[model samples]
Target: MLFLTRRRKVQREGIDYEQIDKEWDWDHFLILQAFVGATVFFLFPSLLHGLPLWDLRGLMVAMVVHVGVSEPLFYWAHRLFHKGYLFEHYHSLHHSSKVLQCFTAGFATPLEHLGMCGVMAAPILGATLMGFGSLGLVYGYILFFDFMRCMGHCNVEVFSSRLFESLPFLRYIVYTPSYHSLHHMEQDSNFCLFMPLFDALWGTLNNKSWQLQKDVSSGKNDQVPDFVFLAHVVDVSFSAHSPFLFRSYSSMPYTFKLILLPLWPCIFIVMLVMWAWSKTFLVSFYKIRGLLHQTWVVPRYGFQYFLPFAKDGINDQIELAILRADKMGIKVLSLAALNKNEALNGGGTLFVNKHPNLKVRVVHGNTLTAAVILNEIPANVKEVFMTGATSKLGRAIALYLCRKKIRVMMLTLSTERFLKIQREAAPEHQEYLVQVTKYQAAQNCKTWIVGKWLTPREQRWAPPGTHFHQFVVPPILSFRRDCTYGRLAAMRLPKDVQGLSVCEYTLDRGVVHACHAGGVVHSLEGWTHHEVGAIDVDRIDVVWRAALKNGLKPV
Candidate 1:
């Protein structure tokens, strides 16, 4: 549920992947070892032989000891760890992570973890020493302790402020994720083990805990993004890759998951529900050089783009998303994947034409798409095969490459469309643009720029050692083992990108689709023009250079 909901996140900032990589394994191993040791020790017949299997009396005693003895002991120990040498050497490690997650609960130095283990064992030992100990009491208390520890460090505010407002006493009894997050942030306050009551008694509680919890739980802290990447779902299987569903899954390139096969029916139902009822919704968000960047999903699938009946509905969603971004004061809104399909919305020209005065720049971002694709072509090579040769990106690539005096075999049946694109090139270079009616014409070309899908049979037409660079949606399958395939155009984000725990579709960490990078470049340059409609072949290099200047490297 925490993964599914955005408003519940207490910190708004993303988890630090680098810190997790460094600390997560060791921390979890230590925690697991501690738990295993405790379990093994308690399983001894000599130690717990006389204990009853169940005892309500011992449970009540354990709760009393937890409040009266355990809380105060841990509270003082935690406070001591904050002062002088203990903090500098031990407790500071735990506090080092500015962002917290579930694993963060165990991310402490060995000595500090040992101290915590002792604190957790206190109530169990106390109850057992009183001759009222039970197996159930020991197991229940230890598990409850661990559960509360994990909950407090989860960094998602699960409990609403109203829960405390109605039963105000509960606030002192149990600490919350928001409460502990304050402790991590401020370092000196909110130091207590699962109970804020001790902090209140010791005058160490942060006063703003309740208000911050209220604000975060109510989503008042979610700021408007400076840039929005208007994206769409690719397919049912790929929908499971949403960051809201699984962080680890979304952080890598997408592949067909056999594990997801069982869930396909349920996922299909969700897609249907989304198609019927959902509008544009926030998928994920991060910061690039302090400017907020958000990705909002269009709720339509990729195949839907080709559906004649679905076109109007998809366009409506796109227009609505663009208008919503403008109203939110977003500086740039880039259309990703099929959201900028010319046949559907004329590369976002429909929205820009409808709303003539939109403050937010509606960018198709195909200029950079064309640029990335064009740049990937081997410069020394004189000729290349081009598929989807008359499409928006294809036209730009064909024209741009022809201007370089490179021979381009544009595979298209429409002579009119081929001639139109060829005419856009310089008169001296126009002769380099040749129209081909079949893929067989590309048998000799080693460099093939694909903007259309190719079947395995059609792929056979390519010569050995041919490399296929693609910009097609649901990228073409690699059927020829002898040839190489280039992935969809993507660019690595600036190194300063922060809070970016989620991947953009199948792209790897810190890499985003070229269209998405285009928007970032637009915002970084503070360009006021809307990059809608046809791709300007001239600005392709300009955008590419600006992207490099802003630290966006081609992938």
Candidate 2:
């Protein structure tokens, strides 16, 4: 592990297929379910058979609409179902059983699951009856979607070189286990049906999120909620018998009351306590934030919260300076930003990358604080921005430093087009710093002004008007090509160096002092993947004082 020296990095888990049986099938269940679905399908046609426009063209349109349109739409809706209130009150059951059995494929709270299926199927059914009848296309739609829906639930991981995935246009077009399994994994982002065309087109599909899952230690598994774990067990063991299908009303009213009477008291108490918890701050909010805030774990854009005047304009920065204060090893992140896809595609600021060091903070309030990706910043950070789009929360600190006279670089999140056209190509960091600017979402990417990273020393040195540049990323090799040299290079920080990218650019004057990655790898200049269990990078540790009770006061 050249990467894991005395330093610690987060753990990454890959696909764990041990729980999924490749050969497993529920033919009888499949047949039965298909019968039920078909019965519904035919019933619609029969009911409307006497309608003026009953025809097969409508059916074709319906199938196509379902496969191409409805599927991806469901993916978007499903992702929401996995979050917040939806997760706790609705969708969690489907995933309660981590080990899914074939029969459990469609098992769900009848009202919730069945209701959604009907809702999803309605549009297609309507479209079909109005016009569709092309046999080959319609059958293709049915067979293809059926297999994917079944296998989507199966634990099997396959690399079948099927046409949709093997052919060029189609290769990236289809959704496979390698593409959809992430739905059952961490349960975020990977929203797509058997087809990825719509999902990918919208930038909402999580293709990369679909890598096979690796098993965490069984011990860790035990730590997850018990209800979830039990669901998996039952999914594998039981068929979809109605939870109350067999229970008849043979129970007289008094007996029924006797059976449900205990539950009422328990439910009442639970509701009362829940009501109290909501009105007070006694809920496990912090713990809940830790366990549920997936955004906290995304490393790359995580630190936007720490940047000073990160997204605020000049006026806002001045106002914010009234508010606070606050990168890369020699592998200077020449630049980086948070790019929201919907807007600001044209480009603005330069971000950095291809380095080994960065210190980031999470940006709160519609800025770029996705993850705190500071892996190699120590390896090349000299002139650093304590804040990125993700670290906008650090604005006050950056502002304070600025009030103390530090010129901080305000970088815009990155983009592909702006980068492709740059005269002197800004290494990777600049690319990451571009923020897409749009209306509903003001931040599409981050754009930085050159003055952001000027150091205190640079402010005073030399005569006025001279150019003093900060960490401008230099071209370097990618990880697959130079992993070792990159790290050892970090180890080689010159003892005499103050810092790699650390610089004092007094453009109002002239002092060209460069900073090194690790204070001084001795650099005149410089330079930056994962696996396995629930590999977690130690979260950013923040200190909080106990209110007045703890003798701590709010500033």
Top model number, TM-score: 1
Global lDDT of each model?
Answer: 0.84, 0.31
Q: Estimate, for each residue in 153-258, the C-alpha lDDT of model 2 and write its tens digit.
A: 5433434334433465764555555455465665765666666666667776664432332121111211211000000001101111111111112111112234
Question: TM-score per candidate, in order?
Answer: 0.84, 0.29
Q: At residue 320, give the lDDT of candidate 1.
A: 81
Against the correct fold, how does model 2 do in TM-score?
A: 0.29
Error of 1 at 92 (Å): 3.0
Best by lDDT: 1
Tell me the number of clashing residue pairs for each predicted model. 0, 170
